[model samples]
Target: MAAAFLPPSLITVIWGFIGIVCPLFAKGPNKGIIQCCLMLTAACCWLFWLCCYMTQMNPLIGPNLSRHSILIIAKEWGNEITNTTTT
Candidate 1:
């Protein structure tokens, strides 16, 4: 349960830190564009993760959502593809 939240949350924190630190080290004429792009990317990453988290928590959408279930499904799909293809 907790493990499911770690990846996206950690990524959001990392991006937030980058967004803050990038502007401080910015130099030259392209500095403004660089800072703006970094900040925009960070914002998008945060928002996307937030939406994912919210959807996972929503009872109406997925009452018993689990990261393990998703992983299992992905693993099964991979196995199916691997078995279908011959080398």
Candidate 2:
């Protein structure tokens, strides 16, 4: 069970490293854009890892919960807020 999460976690780490390295090599007017994209990607990767870590720790802290479900709920709530504010 624990082994299943390792691959995705490793992949996230790889992506984070890519995000960090990409901006350093970028040049010209697009450098800021590249850095912004990298920052956003890193932030998302960090959030994903945090959610997974929370889910893994749930067994010891509280009831077992699905990380996907939590993420879904958060997305829906964000969408709801955006929709309401746009009106």
Clashes in model 1: which pairs?
none
Quote model 2's TM-score. Answer: 0.43
Quote model 1's TM-score.
Answer: 0.53
Give the CA lDDT, 0 to 100, for residue 76 in model 2.
77
Tens-digit per-residue lDDT, 1-87, candidate 1: 898778777887798898898778888899899889888987887888788877766656535758667667778787422324448
Model 1: how far is 52 from its true place, Å? 1.0
CA lDDT of every candidate: 0.77, 0.74
- Candidate 1 lDDT (Cα, 0 to 1): 0.77
Measured by lDDT, the strongest candidate is 1
TM-score versus the correct structure, for each prediction? 0.53, 0.43
> Candidate 1: worst 10 consecutive residues by lDDT?
77-86
Root-mean-square deviation of Cα positions for candidate 2 versus the true structure, in angstroms: 14.0
